[model samples]
Target: MSIKINTYITILMLSSAAFISPLITKGQSTSLDSSQPETVVQKKYGLDPSKPLAKRIGNTPPEIIQKFRDAGMSPTLHRLSKTDSLKVVRAFQMLPPLHQHILKEHLLGISFLDNMPNTALTATVNPEDQFPVFTITFRAEILKQDVSQWLTEKEMSYFTKDFPGFRIAIEAGKLDAILYVLLHEATHVVDGSLGILAMDQNKGTSGMAVNLKSFTRNIWVDRTSICPSYTDSLTSQSRFRGGGRLLPMELARQIYQSAAKGPFVSLYATSSWHEDLAEYLTVTHFTKRLKQPFRIIIHEGRKEIFIYEPMKSATVSSRISLMKYFYAKAGSSVLYERHVKPGGRGFNG
Candidate 1:
């Protein structure tokens, strides 16, 4: 779409802060009390301290068993409900053979539950749908008791600002927060299983549109920007001025190009598209399936991150027209084909 690449870069750097935060140890106890001020210990050796214990174990598969032993904790993966565990396993078995292999290769041998002195949290997968689902549940009373121990061990005040909500939640046995966090991470695993993250190996000129057959829809790129006059009108209003609204199509095109310039996209469009599409699909699918309206809340003084939502009005004829516009501007074929089946469905990768 011939965007000023520099402008796009600026937007990305600014917007990343809100959506991207340093990973926090998922299962670790934190002393977030007022006196403690939520201090974080940065990981040494490039390890992600925020990863779940099971993931940490999985990451260094062979060493995990030894590390747990050395630490003198008898590590046992907690099993939630037998029925739920069976359902999750059956769901995994029902996936396509290749996907099953991917799941086993990537996620097998990982523990789904952790037991602490006073509390326990167990992870479970729900596979009763088209995609695999992961969840975590906590034993409320035990979790609070454990949290109290954590705070005391860290020598932190219980009344601190950061600790208030967390302490209250833990004491009340409100597991929704933990549940949401697990759901978010589990979504990542599901995306990978669906081959939504594969890379397109086809080498072609810049600005060429690549058909992503795995998505069951054609992603079209067109050379267009929001009408200057319309953008000017929107900018005059403080509400829209924050990020400056653009036409939905134009916004999508800008994001597509910006993502194309990202690290993974250089080596493989498919892989890059996987993350891009995952973000897109998550936002869209959540809105549709959960009935939550999509909203982008921007902080004006801060940097901007671009959000793209596919057009509900998009049609094959309209997509063709958009492709032609880019083809004419690039003066090249500007089209790389991926196979799609009739009835608008196909394998993702």
Candidate 2:
């Protein structure tokens, strides 16, 4: 079980049902009751109309999307209906090239091919089985301002208030948080794919040791020791509690505090990380690979405080020194490329 083989197996298994039509051979409608309040229906393998098989087992579809929308749910996050199996197939067909590539790659790495049936596959959970199909239902209306406010209180400010209907907080600029969540969830999926307790299996092993080492090194050396000047006492308390004995990076601590709030917490905080990482990566990719800089700012309005990088050379150098100090403490070397032609770039030393 290589990662590639696992992904292919998973894709093949999912494709059997996900790519098929919902209409049965008997020409009977397979649609579930749209009026049902519960968004998800995990039913046994049967032809029950109440728990339509088509919706629960395949890719998403337009009719299913309509049903969800009519029910005031976010279609982007709902499962397909039994009657609209074809829609699920088509939606898979509509997936963007990058998304499809990533999905296929991920599936191949998880050993999903072995469990796929020769005939059409139905969603089921056998007592002895691994690899369960997850139906993630997205309800946009429920994630309105109330949810957004909760995120704000947790100090996750990297979200957009513009999208009124349905916005995945992961999209707004929180790439770090999103990536962390993805990795964490994907770790679970890998365990299921391998039919082993992935975490427990690695306990006391070299792999676990490396992971712990990286975490410890990052916390003690690479991370900022001082709390962000803007961090409120409540947020500090939350971070201390959530992080336990681990020395959290300032940004990481802020994110952990925010994520402890609720479901939205993880999304909000992770998205912020995503953005930070993305920006850091982008800068590194285009310019020379360098350490990230840190700075502080004070806001006149509401007597609030914030932190950011300044466009001045002196300020940038100071931030860079802090980054270097942290990185060096973590037992990592900093490699700087020869300065390319500087064209009025404020901090291109």
Query: Where does candidate 1 stray beyond 4 Å?
Result: 1-76, 81-110, 113-195, 200-274, 293-349
| Model 1, span 96-174: residue lDDT tens | 2322332332233333335322121222121212222222222222222232232222212111223221211111122
lDDT of 2 by residue, 281-301 (tens): 222221233132222222233
Candidate 1 has its poorest 10 consecutive residues by lDDT at: 5-14
RMSD of each: 19.2, 19.8
Best by lDDT: 1
Q: Model 2, which residues run further than 4 Å from truth? A: 1-132, 142-197, 200-203, 206-304, 308-349
Return the TM-score for candidate 1, rounded to 2 decimals: 0.27
lDDT of 1 at 98: 28
Give the TM-score of each candidate: 0.27, 0.27
